[model samples]
Target: MAKSKFLAAASHDLRQPMQSLFFVFTALERHVGTDAGQALLERLGQGLGALKDLLDSLLDVSKLDAGAIVPELADVPIGPLIDETAACFAPAAAAKGLRLLRDAACDVAVRSDRTLLGRIIRNLMENAIRYTEAGEVRIRCRPAADGVRVEIADTGIGIPPEHLDRIWEEFHQIGNQERDRSQGLGLGLAIVQRLSRLLGHPVEVHSVPGTGSVFSILLPAASRPLGAETRRTGPAADRAGDASGLGRVALAIDDDAIVLMGLRSMLEDRGYEVLAASSGDEAIAALERSGLTPDIVVTDYRLRNGQVGTDCLLRIQEFLGRKVPGVVLTGETGQDIVSEIVALGFGAAHKPITGAEMRAAIERQMARHAGASASPVPEESRVAEPA
Candidate 1:
């Protein structure tokens, strides 16, 4: 508990600056046209990506330790998942002159949490690409008796037999003795192991030292027939191109001035009319004074004076006398907090959220609000706040 609390606090503090940097860089990228500027931006983006990975790894370990992650299982199509995961790592593989191949010929559905499953596969692929100096990384799916086995094979530096069992231990990196940040913090496999156990999936590894490695995850097959056409959805970044929150008013609440500024700048860049405040009361007061109804609310999870983002959202909605779509931005990785946010039916975007992610969440919430408005009673109207 102590460790979790410390990590949560540290993550929240660290992410504030990171989040601000992301917004600033994104804003800069828009005006940067020269090759030198583009190159510099790419390097900065890579640095930010590394920082995000480290922070994410720490939070993930904490969440697993606290048993914060609850898998939402469903009949997830295999082909689309494989396709999407492969596409995500295509750029990295291409950068290394490696091919990312996906053999999704098996038209099967897996009974697992799609998000968690994707995390596992993505980690494996990243690990594969990171370790492999040459050759290709291939993802192949095959039918098993109880379910399907998805194997991530790579022609990289394989793990030794003696070290295989210990690789899943937190901070255990094979061949990275110098503790190089570029090699990753060695938390990927640990997260994969915990998530797999949580989802009741069996994870297997086969490797020949100095040759290659294959990580396989056995996921139970869904008790449903395969559909002729599988719905394909890309990452939020990819889907955000057409979704704009332009001309929509957004209210942001956060105690941190830097975070509030970043949110304001980023939202404004995306054409959103933004109003920012430091607390729930302030946000409500602003709304009451201006008589402005916000189409969407964005807030930090933890606020001043023992308040929280959810309360701010609810207060704003109550003041507006209507349901408003909300996005809860936070660095907190506690299961209880995340559960509460989800229970409130609000969208969640973790701290240090990329421009694309923030945009996607805003767009998603706007769509939801539009749908709710079309209904007889708005969804938020039915949401009963706790006494």
Candidate 2:
């Protein structure tokens, strides 16, 4: 428990700056128009991306060591995950004059934690892009005896046979003995190894010193596609198109002032009327005092005094006398919190979220709320009046 608490706090604190940088870059991207300015912005964005990757890798190690991460197994489609991964790494690969390919069997489902599995693949893709100077990075999915084997093959500088075993060690790097920061902190593969073991997925590597390398992970197969309920609320849903936020009110709560401010700025820039608060109680009080109902609620999962975003969502619904759609923004990776968020029927997005992601989630929630029938507030949700 103490370890979990420490890791949670550390993750939150470390992500604060990255979260702020995301918003700052977002705001900057809107104002810059010159080619030179755009180039500078792009470079800064890349730097931010590297920093975020490092921070996430560190957190993953901490969480894994503390036994805080648990897999939320589900039947997830391979096509969508493959497509998303390709889209994400295409820019980086193109920047290096390399081709990114994805050849995965559609309609194939894998029983695994989507987020963790995605992270593993992403790490491989990022590493592939970093080392490859001119060739291509290919992602292929095929059937295995037990399940499916997804391979990330890179035509970059190949690994020496002797160094293959040491590659999984923390902070171990090959070919760049100078400890070049641009090459990454050498934690990506380490995290991937840990995550693969945690999910009971077997990872394999093949490489020749002068040739390239292929990293593969074998995941259990699922009998059928993910259910409608899972599809509707999964994190991947946040990758949809940007919807307009005109006339919609969003109540956002976060303990960090910088994060709260960044979120408000990002939402207001998209035409949302945002109500910002520091905690669940504050949000409820704001709604009560103003006698205003919100279209959706956006909050950080870990708030002050061990208060969670779900509590705020429930309280906000109680205040509004109807069920209100909500989005939970979090930096924590523990499966327990993720399960709770999904069970509570809220859209979840991890922290250091891009502006587009945040907008998509809010818009999706708003659209759902508009289409669904409003349910009456439950008796248990009613607050007791002061005597």
Best model per TM-score: 1
lDDT of 2 by residue, 1-387 (tens): 676467567776777678878877887776899999999999998888887777777777878877878787988877678888888999999999998988845557888998999999999899888888988999998889988889999988999989899999889999888988888899888889999899999888999875799999998988675555444325644444447668877788988887788788887887888889999778978887777778878898887787878887887777677888889988876767877887777888777777777888777766655667889778875545323
C-alpha RMSD for every candidate: 3.5, 4.2
Candidate maximizing lDDT = 1
Tens digit of per-residue lDDT, candidate 1, span 297-357? 9998887767888877777666666667899988877677877887877888887888777
Error of 2 at 250 (Å): 1.9
Model 1 TM: 0.87
lDDT of each: 0.82, 0.81
- Determine which window of 10 residues in candidate 2 has minimal summed lDDT: 229-238
In Å, residue 158's CA in model 2 sits off its true spot by: 0.8
